[model samples]
Target: MHDFSHCQIVLGSSSPQRKLLLESLFPEANVRIVPPDNPDELEFTGSKNLFAIMRQLSQIARTKSENVTSQLLDPTATYVLTADTVIFVPDDFDTYLVLGKPPEEDRDGVVRAWFLDHYLGKTHHAMTAICLRVPGGTVHEAFVKTAVSMEVASEEMVDWYLSTGEPAGKAGGYAIQGLGSIFVSSIQGSLSNVVGLPLRETRELFERVVQNGDS
Candidate 1:
């Protein structure tokens, strides 16, 4: 198993997929769970620059790490890990259509339908930013970008997917690791990123932290 014997790892996310992925990666380590008191709320009204998106995601992960760390009994012996994922689709106007979890306000199928109508049979990028707050207060971070091609779905298929109530809290109104997998044509990068974490990069980051005695 991957070595992280020196640190008490706390995963700061509520996504089941994220938890499962982390558990599979560090089966030997006892990873704890600490969901954020408040879910992240990002405003998507600006330009979809890659740098800007990465920065925002990194900041969110950093904040989550800090928040989770504050709750630990001994912050000096814990490592809090957090992550955020976003779906990026470029529009025809030389801009991007960034998608996160559908806002709580869009209870109707407006947002969900919009995503399915446009994103189905299209190419998009899924970016995930991960951060680890070491016991020494040093934060290690990384971002992974994956190119995903979605399959074209018929109206009935789209309706069925939406009816499952799985898209409400997912980026791009879909989850690649669940029933949503059937809607994906191909993925060119880290599948774990689309699932909400980048396994390879996350493991490498943890190894570096352990090697440097940051944990």
Candidate 2:
């Protein structure tokens, strides 16, 4: 059993990468992981405006967290978290499929391959929406964005990369934190955000939740 020390931190996803990312800060056993009943959806507005898209993801994250928190309310439960990540190309993308982990063909349906082709050699934004549901009814949220530059990718390169199977379960077609890191040339914002969560912003939110001491 994990220790429920200090405050109970519930992560609403079962991604080992996310768990590892969080543990990088609090160590294993410091946080509790909770998977929500339904996965949060990532939607894009007609505009490729990063800020607007971030706000949309934030609202959906808040709703998901609320739904889970309400169901698992311990009355004394400390904190519950829900997050979503999206990637948008620069120049107001106007044409990128905001992605999540690609679903298995058997379950996820056919995901268009063109989205990956369009993202190559372009700068993209990774936005993470963090929702902290504290004791009582107060809810806190934060959104962070990171800029990523894809190395000039060849059709052969994308094909080879896809063969590795790492992109299948990542928000973006490429995972900067995995074998796909080779596809990136430079990153201007939070690296972790590109991976799915932003550490600095996440830590700040953690402190705020700790100080608020709701439950």
Candidate 3:
């Protein structure tokens, strides 16, 4: 494990989940929370193709890192981290539907329908693209995909969950770490990935950066 006690970590996101995850990763490090500028401005314009969507997710994370790094006075001396996550819901057709956060306006209707129709009793992949901009300007990127299965939920159950207000800003209209966990039946990969950041992969990426910096 790399000791982050002496390092400076700049988290380029407004997500409280990611902030808490990063803090857990580097308990003693100086972690600065700098949200990206115009975060909603960068939209995903990729195709429904899975590979292309994954690439676009990584690009979005990279863009977030760039947005934050541009605000730093000494980018060469600090490590910057940013991440983007989406739920890949398989449709009846051959292609998959990419589900980001639900629209703020229709949390009651859209989110309820999503849980009842697309999410409940269905397995979706939670994909998170992580970008780490190490000191000296080199950027390391990776994506983690986890299969998540949701138990069948009734309309009343979905409505009750919606009343909790946990689905508003969550991808796929649910948060795995919150009350939403009741809906998750199984997960094939890292649970942390579904939460927002994959710890093992993130640690590996940071170690790789440190090794390269030493070389």
Candidate 4:
């Protein structure tokens, strides 16, 4: 395991999953939470093209990092990390649709429709963009995509899952690490990516930033 005992991580998202993951990844480091000033500023609505979606995710993460870093009184003493995740489903026209967190208004209706129309018995990509700003203002950014396949869920199953209220703030209207795990039949990439942050990729990014900073 890479040692981060001497570093401090300033998380720029309010996501509980991300916070837990970061703590697990850097157990010895002091992790601080500093959510973006304007959470809504991370909202992205644009093209469905896979490449375009990837670019947008990266941009969103970078913007989030900038927003949070600006609030830090001593950024040079800590690493600022920000990330964004989304679900992308391919459409009939060879394009993709980006699915973000379910809207608060009629969240149940929205999640129910997502399960019936897009997720159950289908495969979708969970993409997470990570932006890590190391000391000295150097920033490293990357995105990871994981293909998640869901089992065919019956109406009753969907209703039961919805009752758990676990999909409200999650992308694609599901949380793979929670009760929603019962619906995931298989996954093709980083499981952490589906949860929110890609552990291996994120670790590598942090290491690269630190190495470059040292050299």
Question: What overall lDDT goes with each candidate model?
Answer: 0.81, 0.70, 0.85, 0.86
Question: What's the lDDT for residue 208 in model 3?
Answer: 83
Best-to-worst order by lDDT is 4, 3, 1, 2
Query: What TM-score does each of the candidates earn?
Result: 0.90, 0.83, 0.94, 0.94
Candidates 1 and 3 compared: the better one by lDDT is 3
TM-score for candidate 2, please give it. Answer: 0.83
Any residue pairs clashing in model 4, and if so which?
Answer: none
lDDT agreement of model 2 with the native: 0.70
Off by over 4 Å in 2: 1-5, 40-42, 45-47, 73-75, 91-97, 101-116, 212-215
Model 1 lDDT per residue over 17-55, tens place = 899898887753578888888665566567467777878
lDDT of 3: 0.85
Find the candidate with the highest lDDT and give its number: 4
Residue-by-residue lDDT tens digits, candidate 3, 95-212: 7878778898877898887787788898889999999888878788898999999998778888899999988888888899999999989999999999999989988888887776
**In model 1, what lDDT does residue 125 have?**
91
Worst 10 residues of 1 by lDDT: 106-115
Q: lDDT by residue for model 2 over 30-148, one digit each (tens)?
A: 57877777764645646455556766888778877866776675824557777888776554335444655666773222223533554667776788888877766577889887877
Number of colliding residue pairs in model 1:
0
Q: Tens digit of lDDT per residue, candidate 4, span 167-187?
A: 888888888998999998999
| Clashes (N, CA, C under 3 Å) per candidate | 0, 0, 0, 0
Off by over 4 Å in 3: 92-94
